[model samples]
Target: MDGEPRTNPDVPRVDDVETWTHSGLQAFLQALFFVLIVRPFVLLFLGLRIRDRGRIPAGRRPFILIANHSSHLDTACLLNLFPIRRLRHLRPVAAADYFERNPFVSKLTRTLFHILPIDRTARRKDASGQTGADPRQRMLAALQAGQSLILFPEGTRGNANEVTRFRSGIAWLAQAMPEVPIVPIYLANLGRALPKGHFVPIPLFVEVRVGEPLLPRGDREEIRAALESAVKKLKDTP
Candidate 1:
């Protein structure tokens, strides 16, 4: 995975005609939910200590938000960074297997978070020997559609305050769309607030350190390593 990539013909390239914008009503409802419900809960309970927020790419310019995952709350916290109006186009990449398993929770997460669910199962060839749909294509489509994305490159949640090795999917995305900047964010104490199994969250403060955007500056391996390093550097920030 060290080299630059080739375009997948199976994946449709985003043209000016293809877009994924929300309707006026949809945007209104999203703002209502975030402001009336989510905002109060976060401020009153999960207090945030944010740093370098000014560095987040502004005004609908498509960008990738890469963060160290520790809990489900990670997505929620990251989503909070944007303004109410931007919530309509914001998408967080989530696991289809888990979030979509239950119909009720699936509806909740989809309508509220606007998650782009990816099938994390092993990609295999069918009886005809055609491979499965590449998850990266879906992410690439979203980016091309001009929607900002939230990605947990660790692939899954880990121990709180711990940065794990990132998979190369992000590298592939960076190479696929080098124009889109990748912003690194480090979140702390979310795992303890809402751990892997529990439901109710503990009132713990979360520290979010946002780093400067990184371009596709190197080969796939170097890009992945550079992403992991940026988040780790944020973790060690004062």
Candidate 2:
């Protein structure tokens, strides 16, 4: 009962853990890249001051991690918070067009970040104009398989210190997976360190505040508002 996935029967499950599980060599490579490269870059180079870390789900349980998107570094910073062992189950939802643009970038992102690519336009169209599988179903399948997700409800990166209007995609996911927890994270100064369209990261101290998991109550608008308010509250935290 402990290891079994708890989800509605309507949600499809990838029967094989192999879908999410990596080979021994692949696992070792991922850990090595994160530990030797990413961890040091996020922690030592950029500097991190984390709060409410205990609020992050202890183990590999299914949850949606919502954060304000201001910089590309936001994902790296959040990914660095978890231990190496949990990295495999932690998938960051990224734009398919950007992350999967080229074969090289796609492979690198898949190896380093294990990103869950989503179509920003929601068209689900490929380069050949063929309709691809629904990104929402991909998310549902991942959740059904006991994986946590990192989602930037703001959708795209914006001005530093400004949290834009949250997209309703999160609300849709929340409605579908009522049993799953939705965690809010407020990132401070990351946008300044690595703002949009910037390459080299500035050496600025970053603050990561984790808030209580949100209760997906009311309609989609109300649920979206609640999640937005939670992240904003974290921004105001001293």
Candidate that scores best on TM-score: 2
Task: Judge candidate 2 against the unseen true structure and give its global Cα lDDT, from 0 to 1.
Answer: 0.81
Winner by lDDT: 2
For each candidate, the alpha-carbon lDDT, in order, equals 0.80, 0.81
Candidate 1 global CA lDDT score? 0.80
Q: For candidate 2, lDDT tens digit of each residue in 56-79? A: 888657899999988889998899
TM-score of 2: 0.87
Error of 2 at 111 (Å): 0.6
Model 2: per-residue Cα lDDT at residue 83: 89
State, as a TM-score between 0 and 1, how close model 1 is to the true structure: 0.87
Clashing pairs in 1: none
User: Any runs in candidate 1 off by more than 4 Å, and if so which?
Assistant: 1-24, 122-131
